[model samples]
Target chain A: MSVEAVTAENQAPPKPRRKLRNYLLDPQFQMKYVGMVVGVTFVVASVLGAFVYDFSTSLTDSMMANELLLDEYQGSASFQQIEERARAFDRFVLISIILGVLSLVVALGLTGIVVTHKVVGPAYKMRLLLSEIGEGRLSLRGRLRRGDELQSLFVSVEEMVDRLRAEREEQIDALDRAIAKLRAGDDRDQALASLEAMRDQMARSLE
Target chain B: MSVEAVTAENQAPPKPRRKLRNYLLDPQFQMKYVGMVVGVTFVVASVLGAFVYDFSTSLTDSMMANELLLDEYQGSASFQQIEERARAFDRFVLISIILGVLSLVVALGLTGIVVTHKVVGPAYKMRLLLSEIGEGRLSLRGRLRRGDELQSLFVSVEEMVDRLRAEREEQIDALDRAIAKLRAGDDRDQALASLEAMRDQMARSLE
Candidate 1:
């Protein structure tokens, strides 16, 4: 066998990376995204609703806002008149508020689902990676979804795993040496201390 | 055994509630849900685009359209004369078109994200469930998200898993009987065969 191959065999595998979570898999981020969407949706819905209301009642005095395009505020109604208007629109206002609340709740639920998916998707990928590692399949290198916040952590994990793999190789080398000098799985209880002391010395010298 | 202890072991677990996804989680349902959102979004965007385009320009065009009100129809000059008048407000017309397209794109992107999230979230959950089962975590249950279209399939899978677990327990019970009857690992092969045969017979009977 080539000397290079022999050397390579003796070397520990690069440790797998330090463990990192997938960013998209993060429940928190997913929830935040969902919240943002819901907020935006609510704002858009409210604006659209306001516009529709304005269009429907454009001809009426009630349709127009008290603050017009002009600089001055229009105070057209007396207290009695305002009371009459309030009574007239009481039912409409109540119904409108209820409808708005219902819409908001529905939108929030939907946004929550959307966010949960984003968080869960990345999480699944992470679980898959972890399982691979647990099964001693460390050679598996796969791309996580880009822009995941957990990318840095994952990268660090991968590096740590690689380093650990290298250390494992070193440990195995030391074990092989001990086995070659003695017996495999041999009970060394009698010479345990002496053997370990000698082995440590040899390992330090080799390093 | 005390009545309470007997009840604890023998009492049946409450049937898990069926989610819409469990009730409906299927490829066909997924496609339908995605299709509905996609279709509605496309239709909404298209209609809104057209309306925004038509309404914005027509806001002023109504002046020209009302010939009797404008009184500028017959007395107006040649085609060039009308062209000149139209050109005066062409910038606003162009602006409206641009705004319409921008809004259309934004609307489409939002729709795409929402639909994608809905489709992929459950898929991720299913993936995790499969992984857990593969790793000998047979007791793991899938959590179906709300509004998932594969409810029936989820329910069916859950039932299948339960049946499988029960079958496994029966097999293990039979295996224990065989092992107990035998004295050594040397006869383990025969014991395993008998266990398998017994399991097969049980399966056939069930069928």
Candidate 2:
């Protein structure tokens, strides 16, 4: 391939850097969002926990009553035997609830990190690019990591920079031609005409 | 105030709109997020429900056995009386669980809307402004609603546009002066020198 093609390819915005260190550039913002996720998850877990405790107590009472009625009618084994079985089941259920809540908390926390990272990372990249552009660096491009939110906004910003660069080049080219006409010892009328045309071109571009 | 001050104020970017209608621009993305919230909540509820059922059955069995042992030893009461109380508690607990889960679902759904709107609304505004800038309307500014998530990024973008507008005005002003010098019947040598200087100024601005 030609050298021009290679240069153009090289100039294409680099694939967004995805170093692990850079991924959490806006940790405070991400943290606030994650906290919201965790808050919601906690609400669900706590309410469910209350419901489980109450329902378990009620169901256990009924089961014990039925066992006693059977024992009294049939004159079966001692009450202690039935009591042991019921207590064991109670311990098993409580353990299950504890494990379930722990798993939910961990899962939600991880998901919160992944979701907020997509937003915060893109916002951080865009802010840096805007600052560079503000400082008159027209060649810099806006790029976002893959899976970032606001892809359309990034594309529009890149196009805005391209237009600004193109307009600047056009203005400079017009000025160059006007300057050359004056230096070439052109007649007064011709030189004046060139300058006016250049002026008009610049005015039109601003409009 | 001077007219210039008033003009400057007028040119200052308008405050972004914060209408409620505009805030839900990307409902599809927001819906997917809300769906995830609901899914996680559902998992926690289901697990808790199973645990409650097992635990309640176990505890009830033990309670009935103990009560039967007491009655046989002391002739305290009948099994029918205990059965009524157990059924009453079961009904109360089941109703409470139903109410608890319903409230949780509603609360989570509302939270999902609020969290997703904060993200979606800002992204929508930024995208719209970038498109206007891309189309050569450099005077247009980037503005965002207050309390938006990416406020810093939006401020940077607005400043970038301000810089672009100022540079364009400066270049046009330089071109106008050079044009006027060429037209004013000035010495040809002086006019050429001025044009060259204007060209350099434009070049520097682009750089």
Candidate 3:
């Protein structure tokens, strides 16, 4: 195989397609917010729906009274027409209530997921990076996506890692000078070896 | 003064009552999420309101037609009754529309703030703590609140800080041993001073 082909094969695998669950990177955090929004919507819808139902029922009762009065006048045509309009109004109210609640739930649920994702995504990434740092892996290869929330926090973490790396590098350099200085003295090999080991350990931490 | 009185004076100030603006610790981040939620609600409400308005108008027209037919029958009492019902229906539609929109906005907007605050609060605190670490202040005195989002991430950060603190302590201990071993050697004053300075610097970082 050509060198370029071999290098391509050795590279990191392509990211997998995001599944539905992928959007909920932190379900515990995301769901709490989603529940809050959806709950509020439900309460508001219920209260308003009740008011509308009461108004609609009273209106329908009054219209029925008029229908009876017209019946006495032998106005069959007007009675049928008014009855049709009443049925249409009832139908409109029923359909509206059902459709309105459904639309609100769907719209708000999707919006909650999207909005919470912005915060959870960066936090999830940062937690992974932090655990790596805890294990002495000072090399921060991953970065938060653009437009992610917590950009400032991520930048601060990056600066912290950079500062740590620089300090380790300085320690290694100091060990190098100390080892060189002790080389000419008798039985200095033990001290030199110890310093070298420390330097190597510090250098490995940056990898 | 008694020691207890002096200690009380030296203690941190009492937390002030949270103001309206205090909830918006990170306005830029919080508002974007709030805007997305409110915008979706507005679009849904607008579409639904339009549908309701059209249905109401058509229903009103049909009722008016019925009203004129009753008028021709010389039924003044029935006419007035029908007219009053029609006016009442119109008023209900108008009030419902106005009230529905207002309630949805208020409820959703408050939920947005509270939900987003859970995420933003921890992120803001972490940024402050991370910057302190970058400046060699390894002491992490702040903590996330109960019910806050990003609790796992906050724990991971605490672990990272603890690990870093331990590593610095180890480095200082090694320096102590090195300085003690060199104390009896000929012309070891320079080496001892250098090691002591390094140890002090490492110790200070954990302060």
* Best candidate (score: DockQ): 2
Looking at model 3, residue A69 earns an lDDT score of 63
Evaluation by DockQ, superior candidate among 1 and 3: 3
Error of 3 at B155 (Å): 0.4
Residue-level lDDT tens digits of model 1 in A6-94: 88899987685533232234545455545655555455545544543443233223222221211123344555564455345444534
Q: lDDT by residue for model 1 over B85-173, one digit each (tens)?
A: 54555555456445544443455345435544454555546555544444334444657888653344345335534554564455445
Clashing pairs in 2: A56-B56, A59-B56, A60-B56, A60-B59, A60-B60, A61-B60, A63-B61, A64-B60, A64-B61, A64-B64
- Which pairs of residues clash in candidate 3, taking residues 3 or more apart in a chain or in different chains? none
Ordered from best to worst TM-score, the candidate numbers read: 3, 2, 1
Please tell me how candidate 1 rates in CAPRI terms: incorrect
Give the Cα error of residue B70 in candidate 1, in Å.
8.2
User: Which scores better on TM-score, 2 or 3?
Assistant: 3
Give the Cα lDDT of each candidate.
0.45, 0.68, 0.74
On residues B1-207, what C-alpha lDDT tens digit does candidate 3 reach at each position? 999889879997678767658789989888888888888887887777777766676667665665666677865656667677777778779778777977897889888887777778888898888877766666687889998878898998999988877776666556555645554565465664555466455434433
Candidate 3: list runs displaced more than 4 Å.
A1-16, A74-88, A184-207, B1-15, B75-92, B184-207
lDDT of 2: 0.68
TM-score of each: 0.34, 0.68, 0.79
Query: Could you give the DockQ of candidate 3?
Result: 0.29
Q: What is the interface RMSD of candidate 2, in Å?
A: 4.1
| Runs of candidate 2 exceeding 4 Å displacement | A1-23, A62-99, A185-207, B1-23, B40-109, B140-142, B185-207
Instruction: Say which prediction, candidate 2 or candidate 3, comes out ahead on lDDT.
Output: 3
